[model samples]
Target: MSAPLLIFADTILTGFDPDGTPILLEQAALLIRDGRIADAGTADTMRRRHPEVEAMGGRGKAVIPGLINAHHHVGVTPFQMGAQDHPLELWFAERLRMRDVPPDLDTLYSAFEMVASGVTTVQHLHSRAPGDVTAVLDRANRIIGAYDRLGMRVSYSFAMRDQNRVLYDDDQVFLELLPAAMRPVAARYLAGFGLSLDEQAQVFYELRNQHSGKERIAIQIAPANLHWLSNAGLEMAARLHDATGAPMHMHLLETPYQREYAARRGQGSAVEQIQRFGLLGPDLTIGHGVWLSRDDLALCKENGVCICHNCSSNLRLKSGTADLNAFLATGLPIALGIDEAGINDDRDMLQEMRMALTLHRPSGHHSPAPTAAQVLQMATRHGAATTPFRERIGGLAKGQAADLVVLDWDRVTYPWQDSRNGFADVLVRRAKAEAVAQVMVAGRTVYADGTFVNVDRKAELDRLKKWQSRPRTALDEEMAELADAAIDVVHDYYKNWR
Candidate 1:
């Protein structure tokens, strides 16, 4: 019946705008009704007209769009806590072992850390480990629904692949083809590589029916990798995209080794292959496209396919830093991600941005570093675009949701003397998570003044620490328990390539 009043002082990082030009609106005021921004302008103007509204004194805080996490395997296995510094294959093995832990409260706690880090939205490629699929979906829904009530946007993707089932049939074939000593290693490795085409598609279609378009949840496709997926799987993904109208968050060229293997096997590059499958389109987003050629980037631009740049995760796993300049220069849509709950051993976008900036130091040429403003935008506006929620929550503007994060200028973005100094610069580099003065989701202060109103932090974290993680064979220790283990596995898998 009446307009809800909201006001801010000094500055507001208007994340996006109706005019298509997002800008910083100073001393701005906003009026929200039914959870969406009704209008915005100078504080004095709006407060005068909407006289009966409540006031939230800005007290010199900078209001910006709530952060978005574009790529994450949120229910990371606890043993995944300390990832072995390895390439993609070993990383996947560690993830497989991580999945050995039972999914329960521990899974949701991973999502909690994302939220507490000022990540208001997350896109998770749900683990497809051999677990109760129905139970996994059930817990996945519960996790997302919690965020829905908490006023955060979530996009959950089922990690679908035909190779979830052991790709081979008999040990006799492997025994005849390989040395007797290596048969056990080869068998177990291939066995861990699982889902048959029929079963994978069945699981995917079932998940599509259960989650997509239901109560703010959307389905996405995570075609696990090149070796495992079949043509049937890709076709089903396209059909699912049409039926549910959700995005496809596929993993592509995460490592050079995968690309070389595909070439050696005559499977073609993963990018080139997916394109031929008719799966590349606007709803398609590829993660860790590190080996992308200029042609690949152009194809992505031509098809309007976006890339989720997982900077920190890429570096941590030695996958190489994302080609930031190349991606930006292509003029294609790009989004940012931490890629894991405690990715790069941190929980906040601020840290991720910093890493994304410095890791790819240009050779022979240097200039002004990428600005904090641009990095923040990728994490917010661009990251939000990873899902349909972009139009709803990525920006601070009239008719946008009032979801925003207010920073404590004094403590974190220190020496905030004049706006002329570009306050945003300080915030991008120096601000601490504790300095997040207030966080609003859909016009409600879910987290304010260093405390969360929607979920109990202590309780959620306690639940995680208390998850009674499965016995002794932790990936952290055994992932590379002996130097020879990795050397042996690599020799078995890659010797043919050489």
Candidate 2:
């Protein structure tokens, strides 16, 4: 057993209240024992109460709940590769052409980036694996094992998309529009991937039964997106969610084209369609509601559904900005996610928080614009609610998991050191990955002093580099050309949509 730890910080931000008020405490200290927070209070009080505990952190540092990434993907950052700014539909095609690496390396690469940015938990929505049922399940296990080795808390979900792999609607029309030479290639690409809804559900149940009690790992369901699934597939999602009470995460109306598609297909909106499917509830979290209307927001609010705003990914994919102000007005819970498409092309939650704070400010002064405190909550507490880790993490309360980020206040609060300047505001506004001095999860130090403690990140990265240098297959070359040929057709499909 590890010795009890008393962490002292110049200040602590205990996240935000439901009304968006900051809970700032000064001269605070946290008492950790048996991987949980034993107590949190003023440093003097904690020191008096627990005189025997060893201490960490001191003056010139601030501590907060570890950031929660409510939405992300495993082993994929499209913008960093050749897939640059394009609409979500076109970007999907471009991403198909990117090189592939081992799933374990891909998972670890992103996990390191997230931890360096003070994120301790991530909701990893795993994309479809290229294999039969057993192979896909094995790949999921590999991703989970990578996280386990890194000591990062992750909610893993097998992304379920049973239809509409290419365009918002029938992909056959788009395939036909491709050159005759590429027609066969496109068909094979679509057919070769993806599992039936039944197969996906079976895998989910099997994995959940096998790994349910594992430490720091939670299995959930992801329907991919509104247009990606058939009605039967969505029903399966609802059933699995009901059976396991596992949280559900899905992309909804991420682009204007998706909004149009939803309206046409459902005779109303995507939110309404989801409501009809019995999938709207506290357990359901919409990944990116960038194009949700006021009525849709109202429905989400009524159903207790949450939204994870991927501010950077929306901008990178040219998806319209989500009106976070509107979501907040409806009293809906909002969380933050990098979605593997951060503006810096890295999974930096601090940078994402800064962007989210500035992106939603109205031109004129408003009564309730997004505050720095609210953004901090979105990155920390609100995000935890989106996963099963909600009760255990998201705060430094008694009996909660000892997950937190310690920042070098001297590095962040330089040039101005007034206590009245609001530590939460300063940290959110100016802090970067460099300010993250240490990250702890479950009373264990996972990262400290500019290196990971649990695993050799350098060696893992070297393995990835070697894998990337390997020769590309014939399918890789064909997919690159096929993606280029299909981009124009995808653009035209949305352009002419009624």
Candidate 3:
């Protein structure tokens, strides 16, 4: 354990007020002890009370709760792997050509990006890879271990899906649509990920057990999406959540095609189907709820389910914009995520927050746009609700965990003159990764002065470069051709949907 320390900031944004306003303080201090906040008050009072404690961030610093990324898939993006953006349905086909990176290196790469942008916690929804139970467990260990070594809090879930691995139909049915010669090759490739529903559940159980009782790690359930999971798979996901009391993060109705698929499945809306399986509740978080109808929104609100808005992902993949105005009006808990990558292809939460702030303003003069307080709440407090670390790491309070960011206020407000705008407003509108002077998780400094405390960023990046420089094997060449062939078929499959 580290010794007691006080972080004194020229400005402190603790959280939101009851009226949805920001709670700001000037010249305040937070006293941290044993990895938790022990006290908070004016800087003068804290200094008088805890005079012996070591101090940091005396002036030109603004402190706020560490940001959270509620939905994420991988470190390097599909675009970086030579896959271009298409609609979510066709985008899956493009991902087939993505070069495989080792789990540890991939996780660490994103951790570096996230920590630099003041994101101290991430809900890592691990995508299904081509592997059996043993191989899957090994990958999960490497991912969780990477976060452990980086000193970042992670709520890890292996996304479970039993069918529709390639497109929005039965695997055998979709494979038959391919050319005769390619069918067997694609079939062989798909067979590599042949984990039964029972085995998938076993993987989740093993991971949860293995990572239990860790401070900065959490294991949760993720049912991949509406089209990916069969009815049995959905029930299994709910059962896993019920048995372990772990929260679930599921992708649902992310696009119009997905909504149509749910309708055509004869199971009612995706929200209703999940509700039938007892999966709609406070423990559930819906990722990219871009196409939820009025009734769907009502159901989510009634059940206390949260929504994670992936603003950049929605725009990049041609997924329609989610009605953020409606979500706010309905009073549903909202969180922010950079799904595969941000608009700039990096995990910058400040930029994600900025996108969420500006993307919802309609044309009407009096239309309700999101306040900076609301967006900040989404990135911090509401984001906490979507993870296992809820209420433990969001806000800086007397007993909350000391997870926070210290911004160089000078960088945030350089050559500026306005003071009437609220602190949250000014900060969210102007802050960038460059303004993040330090980041702390559990009262430990992980990033400071643009340098990582635990890992060598340039060294790891060079290693990734070396890995990417290796020559492609025959299997990789085959997969690339297979992926290219599947794209048109995947595109044609979705054209007839009403």
Q: Identify the leading candidate in terms of lDDT.
A: 3
Which candidate, 1 or 2, would have the higher TM-score against the true structure?
2
What ranges in model 2 sit over 4 Å off? none
The TM-score of predicted model 2 comes to 0.97
Clashing pairs in 3: none
Worst 10 residues of 2 by lDDT: 74-83
TM-scores for all predictions? 0.85, 0.97, 0.99
Q: Report the C-alpha displacement of residue 45, candidate 1, in angstroms.
A: 1.0
- Models sorted by lDDT, best on top: 3, 2, 1
Candidate 2 local accuracy as lDDT?
Answer: 0.86
- Output the better candidate (1/3) by TM-score: 3
Query: 435 in model 1: Cα distance from truth in Å?
Result: 1.3
lDDT of 2 by residue, 1-498 (tens): 578999999888766665777777899898999888888899999999999889989999998999999988856577555786787888887777777668899999999999999999999998768777898899999999998899999999999988878888777777877889999988887876667788899889988887888658989999888888889988999999888899999999998888888878865799999888899999999989998988888889889998999999999888888988887777767999999658888898999999999988878654557878888888877899899888788887788888899999999877776767676678888998998999999889999989999899899889888888788888889988888888877777777764
Q: Give lDDT: candidate 1, residue 315.
A: 70
Per-residue accuracy of model 3 over 1-498 as CA lDDT, tens digit each: 999999999998887776777777799999999999999999999999999999989798999999999998899888988899988888888888887898888989988999999999999999866788989999889998999898999999999999999888899977998878779879997898889989999999999889888889999999999789988999899889889999999999999988998998976898998899999999999999999999999999899999999999999999999999888887877999999999999999999999999998888989889998899999999999999999997898789999999999988999883989878888879999999999999999999999999999999899998998899988788888888889988978878885
Models sorted by TM-score, best on top: 3, 2, 1
Q: Candidate 2's error at 411, in angstroms? A: 1.1
Give the RMSD in angstroms, all C-alphas superposed, for model 3: 0.9
Q: Which stretches of candidate 3 lie over 4 Å from their true place?
A: none
Report the C-alpha lDDT of model 1 over 111-226, residue by residue, as the tens digit: 55655567777786765554355555565566556666555667776677664222111334433454455456545545553545555556666766766555345566676666
